[model samples]
Target: MSLAHLVPAAVALVLSAAPAMAQEAPRWSFAIHGGAGVIERESLTAEQDAAYRAALKQALDAGSAVLASGGAALDAVQAAIQVMEDDPLFNAGRGAVFTAAGRNELDAAVMNGTDLTAGAVAGLTTTRHPIAAARAVMERSPHVMLIGQGADSFAASVGLEQVDPSFFFTERRWQGLERALRQQNLPIPERPAGAPGPQAANDLPAPPLNERKFGTVGAVALDAQGRLAAGTSTGGMTAKRWGRVGDVPVIGAGTYASNRDGCAVSATGDGEYYIRASVARDICSRIHAGASGQIAGQAEVDDALSLGGSGGVIVMDLQGQPAFAMTTSGMYRGAVSSSEPARVAIYGDEVLRP
Candidate 1:
């Protein structure tokens, strides 16, 4: 062959190789939440509410950047949760709710989809951020779930920062607990004090009237290496009984990820129902079994609500598709993808509306 012909052929081969290499390299995508639900209009002033949503956006942007820069999915998930914890708006880290006993206890979990490896902490009182502790459990501990004092010790051993227990207390959350307790003590009038038919009863404790929803925090991300990961953090249920554990620290119930399948994070309402439903992993399995991510996720949410439960989720499938669905009137959700910016909402309808 002539020298010029050989040169052109070599150049063409090199150009073809470049696209192949690009295709093989890792790409990233991610979505996150402070929590999903209906926030009462009264609880958040326009300005305070805007600040909360903005914090969520900042976290999403930070995590997305990490994933885009070739960071691991685990890193993205934890980073996002950390921001939520710091914000004191959503019930995860620093702003976690007070227990029935008037103490703040936090829980968190993280999982790597590539291996179905998971780690979690429950009833942690001193860890500054439970998500970081959860990751440390995954990376350093021989066990998958740790609790209470032991979880704190493990976090310290692994170089995670510890703060005073008071560091987690928020005046509003403490007052909320007081309100819930006061409602529990109200007496019902037997005859409605004037007029009534059968006479209604105030048997159950007053329902939580907080503007913010069950503000658990979580993230799912596809890393530059194409691995999937998910993490969840929570203050647990408002006015939760002492030692009461919810879905937040449980693997499949609250948070689940399988790189071989997909990644999911669930904010379980009626934790009992979510535990029964195994909501998080079920959604991912449906997607893995050939359902569209949106279809599978929405179906699961509907199923949960149909059973008289309510909550929502944010997820990223193995194909890097993102989906959000809620069983309640709304789910506070946001995402950063090829689609749009990471915005926040008190109502899912507002966020999802066209």
Candidate 2:
């Protein structure tokens, strides 16, 4: 063959491979939320605000690092959430709020967009990382949801890290529980100095309907393979009773992903409202209907607000576009993408998008 003919053919082959090369390159993005609610500007000291921002930046870095390393979106989401779960500032694993019964009960959910498979755990008391347990449930168990002792046992069977229940205890969470009990005029249950026991609930105040509802932490990501995933973890509602499970562990309500539709979502807020509204799934559905991630996310958040639900959401599309919308005054959020530097914001005033 002539050299000229060979060059033309080679050029065509290189052009054909360009798209695949782009797809294979490390092009990914991640977004995470600590929670969302009425965070009054004057309420936070400068040091406190800085601390929250630092924590959020750390989470963003953790997730972005995974994606940059060509890891799966699911792994990125879990890695991001693990950072928040370990921090005493967010309401996930280590910082989970106490239930009305004076115990920390954690819930978490993880979903893979590529396969539409999901796993969740609720009322978890001893798992070191509830998000890991939720991942295990998705990967190892036939069940989509596991609760209480069963979930703990499954976590154990999988050899997920285990910790004493006290490992979840935080003084701030205990104070929040005490305040909630006081509001209800219920006597705080007394226990031996170091014994873990449920607080007596003659009448637990209806889950302390307030800003505390925004303590859940979640993350969503799109990885180099064009796959998407989402995960959410929460210390249920502060002062919740009767084994109440929130939207954090509910696939459609708190977390949803769809590689086919090209979007993933993670929500934090009033769990009941999120459940009734199917917030996360609804966002993905809107994206499927051709709306941008921001539009779909804001629309669902507005709908939830109109119904008296307060909270926020972080949405990421296959294109690495992120949309953060909150009905409340503030949402603890951060994002990182291949095209942009990491960004973290707490109050609405701090957010700057260009």
Candidate 3:
């Protein structure tokens, strides 16, 4: 029911799969990404790296709980994104980056590989959980995409939580805006009306410039029924202008999944390049063409890099195999499956014992 109870249930699931149980019981696979970019090892303090790892593990645990109960891959994807959205560590809902206008505009998308149903929203301002709104659009509305004020309105009409725009503010993101504006030699816009006053970062210090990376959050999963799902959410690039929309809500580009293709993928990096490369769909298509999930992930990353784009992808196959590929020096990532426990890593050099 509650997020706090999720991990324990997942543990019970693993326990139930012991020798006492039938070997035919299905196993699940899941993986999540915070973002991708030039995250060099020396850039992060031990504390910041640990904080990111913890947030990722918590998200993985939430998704594991859903899949543990044989839930749809779509539900697990949504569940994982919701946790990251609420956390201010990654740039999705609460920790979203600010636009040139000094406001948070969020974007999110979700797809059901089982039926090819998908929903997405961009330029959202007041919806507390953009991932939930994306799901609501897929399950309730006739349209596949919604944007700006109409999107928030649609979310509210569906009984999703609506919060004051100020609720999304965090000192860390504000500091990021300052850095981006200064770099571009542009004057900072006045903080929007109703925005919270600047506050101390004693609790969670704003990541230093090099440590910030890209901050988009995403997940891909394989559920017990052999279906796939993928979801991605982000606040867009810091100091973004003219309502710039990224690949996150554009389907196939940043997030794509398909049972028929035998893979689901979520990607993060430079949105424009990913859009051009069609990173997520390209990975799934390669997998469909009989490449192993690992090879597909690497090939997609290589393709994106060839286009002068940087980022990463989480690829999970129908058989519950996981592969992660990134052109960036580091990517915040983690995974859990029926055969292995949850493990998280931030820097690219950290070897994960999968």
Candidate 4:
């Protein structure tokens, strides 16, 4: 049957035999993140605070509008991240992190559920939109991941703007790098205090974990055509080495979407644990096998932390249910749907305030 004729038949079938599916099909799917954990009240100016809330609303609105207008879920996901990437407050695009060598090496990834296709880039110094480059990598290249100058070169070949590395510099990140360097130099005791438990890597100088938390912004969407899509973007861990790569650009690590499974998840923080846990895709698989969105989202995160990982996640299930979780005190998050306008969450010290 033609699409126009098929629409009414499909609607009738859904209404009569699968009303739940009908309900889900027309609804909007959107979620956002500013950052996770311990964003002190004193740390943000009123203007900055307002910007966070505004960005969340805009991202949610854009995604919803796209889904409402029959746009692809992938388009909605990318559109939401583009908004965040343009905003300087978030650690993406314009305000991305500076490396240990004092350069910007951004990372981003995207996935399409219809066919399980995905793309990513790591250690990119400049490209107008790293997410777009990631999509290009997914669609145009035979490979799934690209790194360093090669990634940048691929992006340039695809017509993405290659800004100077200096464009990524910002005063806040420069100071953050300086602080991380100092923390690296602090001496460790010569030997174990008591027993020979695995001593911390004193000589390697791991970056402090408490610096501005490594929060990534992402979206999981159900488009008008009922397809699923997801994307994630980040500046990577603060004070990271120039060539350091994180889970943000890793498919199973930071982002995953599976239409048949009915859920998509995006993760941020402690890339090593995310990879070990397969955090994002695990959540989707759990939900597909009958776990609640809330339980599936939290369980994987908890599992990662049990193995010493710390980070937050945003998740959405086939039923249009949404959940956000983190081991941290709070994970800067928000959600919106046809049933509701917008709701944002943040931490007020030990308590979570919505």
Every model's Cα RMSD, please?
Answer: 13.9, 12.0, 7.5, 12.1
Q: What is the alpha-carbon lDDT of model 3 when measured against the actual structure? A: 0.82
lDDT of 2 by residue, 1-354 (tens): 111222232223223322243453338888889998777567677767778888999998899899888999999999999999998888899888888778889999999999999999999988999999999999999999999999999999999999888788766677677887899886675532453345632212222225357679999999988999999999978788899998888889999999888789999988998898999999999999999777788778778656776788889888777778776667788888776678777765455321
Give me the runs in candidate 4 sitting further than 4 Å from their true place. Answer: 1-26, 40-45, 186-209, 348-354
Arrange candidates by lDDT, descending.
3, 2, 4, 1
* Candidate 4 whole-model C-alpha lDDT, 0 to 1: 0.70
lDDT of 3 by residue, 1-354 (tens): 112222233223223322233344338888889987777667777888778888898999999999988888888889999999999988999889899788999999999998999999999999999999999999999999999999999999999999998888887888888888899898898876776677644437765544233889999998877888999999989999999998999999999989999888888888898888888899988999999777777777676757675677888887776767776667788888877788777766555432
Which pairs of residues clash in candidate 2, taking residues 3 or more apart in a chain or in different chains? none
Error of 4 at 342 (Å): 2.8
Q: Which residue pairs clash within candidate 4?
A: none
Clashes of 3: 0
Report the Cα lDDT for residue 112, model 1.
92
lDDT of 1 by residue, 1-354 (tens): 111222232223223222233343225667776665544565456775567667777888889778767788898888888988876667877778777676778999999988888999999988998999998888897889999999999999888899877677665665566666677773222221222232332112222344223778888888767788889898887667749888877888888988666655555455666777888888888888987566676677667556664677777876566666665544455666433345455554353211
**Candidate 3 has what TM-score?**
0.90
> How many residue pairs collide in each prediction?
5, 0, 0, 0
Best by lDDT: 3
Error of 3 at 313 (Å): 0.5
Once superposed on the true structure, which residue ranges of model 1 sit more than 4 Å away at CA?
1-26, 40-44, 186-213, 338-340, 352-354
Select the stronger candidate by TM-score from 1 and 3.
3
Off by over 4 Å in 3: 1-26, 209-213
At residue 271, give the lDDT of candidate 3: 88
